[model samples]
Target: MSLPLPLIFDYEEIAGKFYPVIPIELKVNEKRFLTRAYVDSGATFSIFNAEIADYLGLDYRKGDKIYPAGIGGHICAYIKDIFISIHNIEICCEVLFSDEFTVKFNLLGRAGIFDRFRVCFDDSEKKLYLYEKAYSDFR
Candidate 1:
């Protein structure tokens, strides 16, 4: 069965331009941090700013280090397992935290989120639909 939730795209003003963004919660142990993220289909992994790791009291340096090149060039990131909550659906997955990821928005990429959910983006109507592939993480 599909998850009944369909998220509306949130418009955020960045440098006088509006962009569609989504709200997501980052979880580590019992700590949760709510933040806005960009749904980036081109990204290979979910990546966030390292400040979030500090907020979660994580020693982010302890995570697996990696260098990923993107349109903006290469960046250093650390991979850590954490629960990412979008609305009520939560999934435990690997996410990268980077001090070098200077973009204003964190990225919800293909690896963890896309692999677990069937995602549809409607730009004309500004809507995002996410359907769960499994019930394991539905709350």
Candidate 2:
């Protein structure tokens, strides 16, 4: 059986817009882990704070420089590949790595997850729905 879609919520109203936390899982090397991450559609790439990366034991190295919005001006980060999971659905994708000292939470950007899933937000129900396009027609 396929996994059910996850509920979405308005980021602004829920987490004051700075950090819109979404419940999801991170899968790596065939292992699945659960964590709540911030959904940042504005971000061109996904990111994981240092703590989360270390916790997952991801062997990541410094990649090309990336400029991300920060409290001051823009913050620089590195890139790496990680398996991300949501509602039991897992997909390995490239992600940015940064120290938690700069960012408040882990960010889920538009690159990987949003590319494959159709997202719907129900304001009335305060839930966000994520549907895999590949499985949309399957009954």
**Candidate maximizing lDDT:** 1
TM-score per candidate, chains pooled: 0.86, 0.72
List pairs with backbone clashes in candidate 2.
7-128, 8-127, 8-128
Candidate 2: worst-modelled 10 consecutive residues by lDDT: 10-19
lDDT of 1: 0.83
Over the stretch 60-136, how does candidate 1's per-residue lDDT look in tens digits? 89998999898778989999989999887788878899999898788898887887777887665656777767566
Each model's RMSD to truth, in Å?
2.8, 4.9
lDDT of all predictions, in order shown?
0.83, 0.68
